[model samples]
Target: MASYLAQEVQLARRHDEILSQRSVLLQQMETHLGDKKTEKTLQMLAADAAYKRNTALLNDIEAAEKRLQAGVHLQPHPNIVKIETLYWASVEESIPKWEQFLLGRAQTPVGFKKKKSSEYNISHAKVAAQR
Candidate 1:
């Protein structure tokens, strides 16, 4: 929320600066086409790059404002609440450690030792190991 507000303020500052520059360019455009030595004035007046950049910035600002209005940052995530609730419920029910694995409360199992089965070692695999 605070981050978006800060960006909004920054964009407004840039908007004002661009408007000031646009005014200057427009004024130059008014007197420039007939003048042979005013290439810079013509270039400045004709370039739409700045306007396009500002248009993109305006889009971002509008999106941020919409998110702000929706109060997205203040809302609790439904998934997070559900996951925490499940965890706490499991704890409260005194679920057995082994059963907790079936309930999705378990951490990853420790590494396993290699077995007589040779599926992982192709060179050692035999006829019975073949699918």
Candidate 2:
């Protein structure tokens, strides 16, 4: 019984650690997503909201883990919380693609016709006549 309790406590501690890492990753993702300049302002706002939601979920997970550690008997489950997976899926893959797309679009050069200089200078002629 004592061993089982100790194992449970260890598991809860591990879960807390995982949750903390996940929270950090989510925060990073939110920061990155917030920094991006999207073509559609509405999409940027929506992305911001998504980042916030992910952050909030991570926080909730951490809080739940804390409650579980404080003598709260929560249902036991395997470690399904993955920080790396979430980071890669949400931020790592998308940021590079978006950045590349933006960069590619920006690289397109704009052409403008240069104004030709007149061989005859009317202003010079006027000045010469005044002199």
Candidate 3:
């Protein structure tokens, strides 16, 4: 409850900060436009947009807080969960394909064979020494 209130306060402060910054920007825009009528129109539009965005965010937070306070446990839909699980599982299954696409080559499989140190010949040793 306290956390929600703190979050709400923080959000309000941020919204006000954004509006203050935008007000300065709008003043600069008004100077650039040089038409009182157009400047007023633009200012109104900007303010309306900002108000909508801020109100929407505040409403969402308020709703969430209210729901939390109500203490009503809600269960997720099984179908939705099942679908998401399958989707993620498919994504996990296709990771190798994604790696191949991104890398422009096949990914080395697990437990790939490697030459034993004993398999290195004198020529190989000489090449390594040259490097």
Scored by TM-score, the top model is: 1
Q: What local distance difference test score does each model get? A: 0.77, 0.75, 0.86
| Collision pairs in model 3 | none
State the RMSD for candidate 1.
26.7
TM-score of each: 0.29, 0.28, 0.28
lDDT of 1 by residue, 32-128 (tens): 7657457767777667777888899999999999989889668579999999999999876654544656678876334434454455565455544
User: What are the per-residue Cα lDDT tens digits for candidate 2 across 22-62?
Assistant: 99999998887876644467787899999999999999999
On the 0 to 100 scale, the lDDT of residue 47 in model 1 is 75
Best by lDDT: 3
Off by over 4 Å in 3: 1-34, 72-131
Extract clashing residue pairs from model 1: none
